[model samples]
Target: MAAFDALPGAVRDGAVIVHFGSPLIEQRRLAAGEAVVPLTDRTLIEVAGEDRLTWLDSITSQSVARLRAGDSTELLVLDPQGRVEHAAAVFEDGASVWLIADEADAEKLAVWLQRMVFRSRVTVTVRSDAALAGFFAGGAAEARLTPSAPNGTPLIWRDPWHEVQPGGHQYAAVEGHPASDYAWSVAVVDDPAALTAPFAGALAAEALRIAAWRPRWSNEVDERTIPHESDWIRSAVHLSKGCYRGQETVAKVHNLGHPPRRLAALLLDGSDVVMPAQGDIVLAGDAEVGHVTSIAMHYEDGPIALAMLSRRAPVTELIVRTHEGVDIAAAQQVIVPADAGATAGVPRLTRLSRRPVAEDPRNAR
Candidate 1:
């Protein structure tokens, strides 16, 4: 509780400072250890009513109808033309569901869903005032935790990583009250203020995500972006789920054919590097094949990025050229789609060769 008193108002507004529950400062890579980051841009929406799950499943990429209370799913909602309009972490309680995303998209997504509810007996309310306190731990953790959001999203008390110890690795996203004196988590953490004092601009938090290889919705997804092209097939898609918007295209491209372009991890050359802004051209020798989506100077990996490139681009190291025509070091590594099997030992920075990416037929031309 004492921690909240020391934090700057910025972090207090959108997030709470919690402990790593262990002495993580001793680790060589502090970024890989626990740390606090601001979460001002994100929002939470509440969908309450008898028809919550069934109604949501009709529009989202995942089949929500099967989620038991306390269960959550990563979801994507596509526009009529098949472009992603909203990406969220959805969790269901007994009587409601919560959709968490950036504030700019929460109300719009909820409103869009509400309008589509003719007689489904559903009620969607945008909870723009709600904020999140989250940690992405990567070690061993218990499967069960308390529910914090109105939709009852879990409040994980242990590490989430499977191999890490009880306090090892876990990713927990919980709803918190406003930073006013009534804050909820202050009782548990000491020096909340000091911990949150460092979060200012979104850049610091973005840096953490970049180091974590987390692909953000704003910088990575859009109308022209296909699900597979953003690696949405990995964490966000549920292939076995029944129909939803854009399901046809998703299933066809994933199971029957390779996506025209594949997402890849780009290690930007940072020595004389010009950060490749979104839409900048990526090249292999003289051939223009792909474009950079999101990038940041990594604390450990130098400059790293996510991009979508022509799958036919010779699997080779290349340069990312800015719109201003500056050459930036761009190494390509395929973002294997969900249908691609046996990814156990794939290289993270694979060369873009003509060779089949894997033995899987999904990678076949």
Candidate 2:
């Protein structure tokens, strides 16, 4: 981060590079696969030993036990109530399984993983020495550039949001989602200075992610967020997988009912020149329905954001009230459709059936 931050025209937010003073240009370069962004806000964890993949499979939501080397996927750790706890990109390199998670979640997740390893032949360690560089390589030649492998395989985790995996489900009702073609991946390196590609900042990278309707851990998840609400089940969850901590709730909510809330993308009104901040109140007329989660300025899409709206929130325009008292008119787009879940074709009984039917002696005659 220090080396990348020292680059010319680099403007930073904390340890992260926001942009090289020309976000629009940097966004263009990044979208075209001509630039790589240093991911200072991400951290790596290595789970090594013979039981690594099987242990991970037994705990997480993804079907990872049989993952072949060089395979990439994502998984979510859920609380007992099916709320999201931790999310990460998973890659198998034969020697170990690398989990690239957000900086805010890495430490806690690693600690939890350690505690869960009572007799399992696995060692979970934080790879604090490794740094990540993100690139948008959609099967391009630029994607071939990779760092040296530490365990007989390149440490690159390609994102799996382009399409739903086996045993996964999508909630977005559209025929084609913008993220269906999104190609983003991260390369692990020991030093940030080792990358020679043109640099984009975290801001540019975030804008592209938001534009693709991607749900990230730090931005989209909250204490009560379930995978179904953000449509995370599309990639991070295996619907047909064996039992795990939150499997009951995951199965129930997806097959029997809808999530209490759904994720929505918004196109904000740029007339105010002030963007709504995270946690800002979103409204349907006078009723508060949701709060803004992630906001960004896209090169082509203008101002955009993602929010968690209540199931009661109608499918119409919404109002985003900023801290400065500016009411930004936002047009809402559905990421998770209203009819997302209850997919299982089971014969559901109604409450009326639970009531005792009246009996008459004359009926017996």
Candidate 3:
């Protein structure tokens, strides 16, 4: 609270404050290009030395070997079986690569990166002094408040969720994807004090993200989560990239099979003025099908959530069982369909015809 005490009104959630007193109002202003938010829980990792990009590209999900200075993209470190381990927003300056990740995962990601630096000239260091802030409506203009990179461009990561990147593919089969409207970016600074503008809170930012159908590593991911399940291939995974740790699994699932589960966007019934908490059981009539991964109240959409449901679960109306034993009606918008994969378009063998009548009669005669 001390860090935000200077602000006129605020609300706290756990150790980090979630929003200012007027989150809906702040959300409106943020969408209107009038506000920015200091993402207090985001941290930075710096990778230096000439081998940084090549070394990173050899291990992660994205192809960063040719990532030019001032270019921005995100990468994922998947386990040997292709389960998501770590995700980061990545960019490079002339001398170093900067990774923006959840604060709770920064040190862990840094340690893993350091362990993989065998014989390579790369050096990994977590920059505790730096912080990340986000802006949506005027992200490019707001990014100007931060320090510039060697190329004279603001050190900002333009989010790639709005469109699929070079080696990426979209799993959402919708004609016009809702994520096309997600205009978001983040800027890193040595100190939050450099951002002199009044800011909104994390809640406001989260609401917008949910509405845009964007998935966060912290909220949407679980121990067994794979990129295919979250529709994350739209931004994180590179289908044509060369061998990485989990490349085999990624290739097989995307080309030959469907993910066991899929992500869904939910419109929650807000008649009771109650919201479902994370991990709330999502039910299809009397049977449990999945669990809510994230929920928020949007300025435009009254209440919305993102859930990872079994791919076999019917894509019809559902209900969310709150922690308090209350049932909240939920209408779903399919993000990833049950038949999401099989992108390779392999043909099936035809069955032989069973017309044996003429042949049998001739043989008998």
Candidate 4:
């Protein structure tokens, strides 16, 4: 077994791994014929009933009506006003459907769903204890990527790099299937201690994820944010789907107007010091441009951060203003903006950008 000795203890406990390299490796080997990794900081919500898919599709931003027993979709729950309430990986089996969401908000989402079950035949429950894991590295590894819990189940994951790059890599949750849409086979290990025991000298995967510009649910989303503001519609929002709670706002802002805020990746120069704390103000000149969502010290790229800022802020270069009012030099990489219009055939204008944007962490290209 190829133990992940380079992984950190926190990650081994229940976190994802983000391995950086000078050049992306095409192949990696794993022990037990399964490359197991912990899906940390996430929770799973179970919805069981005959109308599980119907109930979800009516409330979320995706077309769950089309999802079969062995399929999954990236789903986003919106506030009545169209702001992001929560995001999840919605998967279905013959018997039930599972929603994988942020650990911090899984219970909240589950409760909300239960409240909405006024007359539906659906039942909602929190299954965060049900572990989620995956693995993939080289080509044609999809067949080997399977969830350990159930055999022959369909897996669904947000295609981390859908807009910036297509088919670069595939992410999905598996239940019963022998394999998934990844380069390596993966499984959910009940033994967190044993599973993470072999990894050595690795930092928290959250740091790598922050550097990658991947927007996690808890770290990146909140009530103040809309799906478009977070660039979530790219992977989570199914624009063409039928009416959901926040569909009107999503459609209007996306098609005829623009979102108030945009998500950016900041390049911080920390050669002189450590990175600033989260919620620090970012400035352009004297203008309060935005606030940092996540920050990290990259192994190769130095200091970097993800932020949601006003649309008028500098798209090329910006500055991070510390609480003490000291300004640090930084460059902005606009990953997901409200202005990017919808894409064709994919069912939404979430990807309608005026020009090519920078590389997003989810899809490093």
TM-scores for the candidates? 0.69, 0.94, 0.92, 0.72
Q: On residues 73-139, what C-alpha lDDT tens digit does candidate 3 reach at each position? A: 9999999999999999998886789999987888899999999999999999998666567787364
Off by over 4 Å in 3: 1-8, 137-144, 148-153, 347-365
**172-238, model 2: which lDDT tens digit per residue?**
9888789876889898875566566578899899999999989999999999899999889889999
The digit string of per-residue lDDT tens for model 1 on 221-297 reads 75577666655554566676777888777766655565666667787778874577888888889988878777765
- RMSD (Cα, Å) for all candidates, in order, is 12.1, 2.5, 3.2, 12.7
Q: Quote the lDDT for 214 in model 1.
A: 49
Which ten-residue region of model 3 has the weakest summed lDDT?
Answer: 1-10
Winner of 2 and 4 under TM-score? 2
Clashing pairs in 3: none
State the lDDT of candidate 4 residue by residue for 173-264, as single tens digits.
12331122322222344444444322211233444455545576776776678776756665577767678898888887776676788878
Output the TM-score of candidate 2: 0.94
Error of 2 at 66 (Å): 0.6
Q: All candidates' lDDT scores?
A: 0.56, 0.88, 0.85, 0.61
Best by lDDT: 2
By lDDT, the better pick of 1 and 4 is 4
User: Which structure is stronger by lDDT: 2 or 4?
Assistant: 2
